[model samples]
Target chain A: MEKAQEIIFAGFGGQGILSMGQTLAYSAMIENKEVSWMPSYGPEMRGGTANCIVIVSKSKISSPIVSKFDSAIVLNQPSLDKFEHAVKPGGLIIYEESSIITPPKRTDIECIGIPAMKEAQKLDKKQVANMIILGAFLKKRPIVKIENILSALKKVLPERHHHLIPLNEQALEVGRKFVQ
Target chain B: MGDNESKNEPRLMKGNEALAEAAIRAGIHAYFGYPITPQSEILEYFTLEMPKRGGVVLQAESELAAINMVYGAAGAGARVMTSSSSPGISLMQEGISYIAAAELPCLIVNINRGGPGLGTIQPSQSDYWQAVKGGGHGDYHLIVLAPSSVQEMADFVFEAFRLAEKYQNPAFILADGALGQMMEKVVLPEEGSLPYTVHNWATSGMGKRKQRNIITSLHMEPEKMEEVNLHLQKKYKEIQKEVRFESILTEDADILLVAYGLGARICQKVVELGREKDIKIGLLRPITLYPFPKTEIAKLASRVQHTIVVEMNAGQMVEDVALAINGKCPVSSVGRMGGMISSPEEVLHYVETMILKHFVSA
Candidate 1:
């Protein structure tokens, strides 16, 4: 039986946290992996706390909600405080350095603070910070291939944004290279 | 199998979205639904897809109007559906009863949320009595299909349509908020299936037919109404015979876990946990909740020393389990109400104390 990797993506609503989880889930589907993505729904998702759980497994997933995560990608300080303790021992926590003032203090899990906002600014689009974070996640855990994620982008993004594919791909590459 | 043979590619879809897509691919002619959380995605997805497929999609004034619109479309011999959550489903009960009494073929989806009133928009099986026992004021049963997975959410739409038309009865897909909100890989159905065709029974302007079809629930004559009730009872009996259930790891089990939908999925994990500790535990999942799958439960009841019914409600379906067992074994229930999900460990602990520990002492 193959292993199941559960991930939590948490941040502000407009920070692309949900979309990051969605892209990962779609990529997992492209790779024929059993996957489930559950987002924080209701009023809290407007401009407040928002998060999504994405589980990729090789077998049927019993539940979509995760109490403990194999990895967490946090884009803000509150998300760091909220989910840092939920990461499994020896797991990975990736956060955006610009948004989080105090980084995760856990010694058991590997914590990587990426300057995602700065990196996205370098790409001429600060909104793609989530993509940078996603790229770092792929670097840390290469569960799904980068090629699959690119095709998934085409499927998820609307037709009008087709021209932005190159920039997104560049953002992913920057994150992957910077994480090393 | 025709659609399954061709362009059936796996797409990451939410349960509600898959249900809407399946409805279109299943040749649904009309969709009338009011937006309600957890199930609002179903309505939203339909608004785009249904019109593209040359079908009618209406956001009705309210849940009452939505179900009544379904009743009208079903009487016209068009495959139609309406989806809502618990509170909305409550408002739809009167129309649903009318459709069932009229013996019209239509599908109603309840993406159930916690409730007695405007309950929290969280997953719950509290509507078991409402879906299985006929919530509306009548003595008729709706064929209730409880889907656990996103795949089943899509697949069952076709099956619900088929069964509804076969029996000329209103069928329901009784899912929950978790199933509706969560996303999973789903194999989407290909387009182009034969749409519903009940030309003989439909009131289609009496075109080239010797007699006009009258679709109405009220039979003013007492004797005629009795005959109609008897006919419905007979169809329900046939449905009971066609019940679908799944029994897992029960060949040498000491305890049987009876659950349906999401509860069953959680119980499956408990089964693995129990076996790891060398305890004998199995799962009995009811796919067709209306039929209740009593025969299989009864057979297992004779074998297992203890049975525990797990649900997301305060012990509604447990009554059915106890009835099916008929004192062959002790049947009990443990569940979380009002949208609180009992963790698998909590459930396992409950089973250990309630079933295993009790059996050891006895």
Candidate 2:
């Protein structure tokens, strides 16, 4: 496995992109790894597009800002178009085929079009599309254990949101199965 | 010192532990501070630890009350101190002026945060003018120490108290959020250094003093007020000679970066990156914003072609740098307002494009 990886999540405002980045970063920190999660949204957080960068590494990261990303996950068409060329060559690009109509234009990168939203709808939770994407990310780059990710989600999410945890886990399982 | 030198001295500790340790070492007995900030730790440390070592830590209701408490404590000739952040310090200005007017000895610490309003819980160095120009109403000056590192933060608390006693005036430690949050290795002071005596003028409960000593600033006569102001002005002039500090990498450089508090640390990285790129850049980190380090900066002005002042605010400290250099060096300012920190890369880019490129062309 790589010693350091930079992952970016880009999507529409309501797509839980920031939460997904935070969960991944928190999971890495739980495993005693250095991680930095910075979200990008000002007025964009209200209704416009939103994105976040999560860097998980063994050594301390020099700069939190990234000029190029190791992995890019797009949940919307605009996000896909915006970040396609920015993904590093031979890196992975996971796009939700149900929401993002156009695929990435980068030929050198591995593009995996997972129908994450469709899979979440099957689980009767449209909001868990982010979880599905997260599960795919974990399968692609298993830097942290599945148990750690679940525990991290439980710790971060409020008690009222706990009931939805198992369903989100199911969505992740569906994503992992599809990707495998 | 020998016992403390051996086996890591048994000292009670807290977030405010550094201040108490420094206070005891500086021989301070009377502590008058209201709880605020990152500074609540200091108050808690004193409350629990001060009594064990035969000291007084009074938690006042408000910052105004706290500063007034210090004034009273100092009046009684006890080594006195108080602390608060920007908003709380604003409330203490009236009492601070009284202490200044009376020429009493006391130390104050301001752990700064983002402001102009009730800002978020993040670090900022936006209180440059408020601190240097005497935040309280008066024709008075304060001995302001701007500490950039954690070790300096702990050490300056003691230094501020010492300077206060030495000059018979108020001293301030202007610290920001980063220093408060950052954990660094700190050596505890020895135990026997706790109790130090104050001057004969301090009212120790009126025991064997000529009549009862009156600590008042209510001399309504114009001549007396003028005389008081003149005496303060003379003392301030003397303090200018005692204004001591440190500057890193400012000699024979093309671009000079002027920053204080947390911003200075980031500027250090910026200077290092510029040096790697073969750009002659240095930093003038103001350890004391007041006394403004004008002479040191004026000397650097002859050598450095340009200077850039980076701060967490819009443009507070840059004005001081521009004034200090007397326009000999073209000074520009870059900052991020509203609880955001200016990134090192952002500052480096500004230095390269604004200062370095311009100087090279000239």
Tens-digit lDDT track of model 1 for B215-318: 99999999999999999999999888759888899999888999988888788878877898888999999999998899899999999889999999999999
Measured against the true chain A, the candidates' chain A TM-scores are 0.97, 0.95
User: Which segments of candidate 2 are over 4 A away from where they belong?
Assistant: A1-180, B1-17, B189-195
Look at candidate 2 and give me any clashing residue pairs. Answer: B16-B42, B76-B203, B77-B202
Writing each residue's lDDT as its tens digit, candidate 2 over A36-91 gives 56555334654579887777888654344464689998988888888888887889
* Docking level for model 2: incorrect
TM-score attained by model 1: 0.93
| Proportion of true inter-chain contacts also present in candidate 1 | 0.56
Worst 10 residues of 1 chain B by lDDT: B1-10
- What is the TM-score of each predicted model, taking all chains together? 0.93, 0.67
Worst 10 residues of 2 chain A by lDDT: A38-47
> Considering every candidate listed, which one attains the maximal lDDT?
1
True-structure RMSD, every candidate: 2.8, 8.3
Total residue pair clashes for candidate 2: 3
Candidate 1 local lDDT, residue B272: 77
For model 1, the docking class works out as: acceptable
Q: Interface Cα RMSD for all candidates?
A: 4.0, 9.6
